[model samples]
Target: MKDIVLYDRNCHFCKASKRLFEKLDWMNVVDWQALQSVNRPDFSQEELMEEIHLITPKGEVKKGFFAIRRMLLRFPLTGLIGLILHLPFLKPAGRFGYKVVADNRTCTFRKK
Candidate 1:
């Protein structure tokens, strides 16, 4: 089973995130899906657009920073960072940071 990630296709930040993570998926274990195209009964479209989502091979769902951490764990080079994010004290902070960034993703890019 593959680890599937759901993201908004229209969001530049989301698209960039997908590209970055896909590059780290050297073993080809991940499958990325655009939120507008996939029929995800488990989550509403609005909910997905609010943050990134990852469906684990075991059918567990992870969102935002948790999803990102999971993706990081899949790569050898980034696994250490992933483990750091899982530390109990850092989890909440990580989630908050992810929300702040995700909520204002448009700010990350602008017309030049």
Candidate 2:
């Protein structure tokens, strides 16, 4: 199933991340949409701004850290990274780390 990734266009980090995904997506299994362009009835603008979103072809939505893990699993190489992130001992930590990064992505990038 094709996956859709909703990313913030105004964020340099988000845009760079999308470009990285394009390079890593050997199977072309994911589709990209700018968060500002999304008008999904199920997701409010504020919700989209809160974090990244991954929507499955079946219409299931995975948000924030979960979305990143799910997207990683779609590719052969990154699947292991996704699996590792979800390991019982690491899941909580991974989620926390992702949240920190997501929340400060703009500032994080600006520091560079």
Q: For residues 28-67, write the lDDT of model 2, one tens digit per residue.
A: 9999999887788888998898899998999899988888
Model 2 lDDT on a 0 to 1 scale: 0.87
lDDT (Cα, tens digit) per residue for candidate 1, span 38-110: 9878788789889889999888999899999988987777989998888999988998999899989999965
RMSD of each: 1.3, 1.6
Q: Worst 10-residue stretch by lDDT in candidate 2?
A: 103-112
lDDT of each: 0.87, 0.87
Stretches > 4 Å off in candidate 1: none
The candidate scoring highest on TM-score is 1
What would you estimate as the lDDT of candidate 1?
0.87
Please list all clashing residue pairs in model 2, or write none if there are none.
none
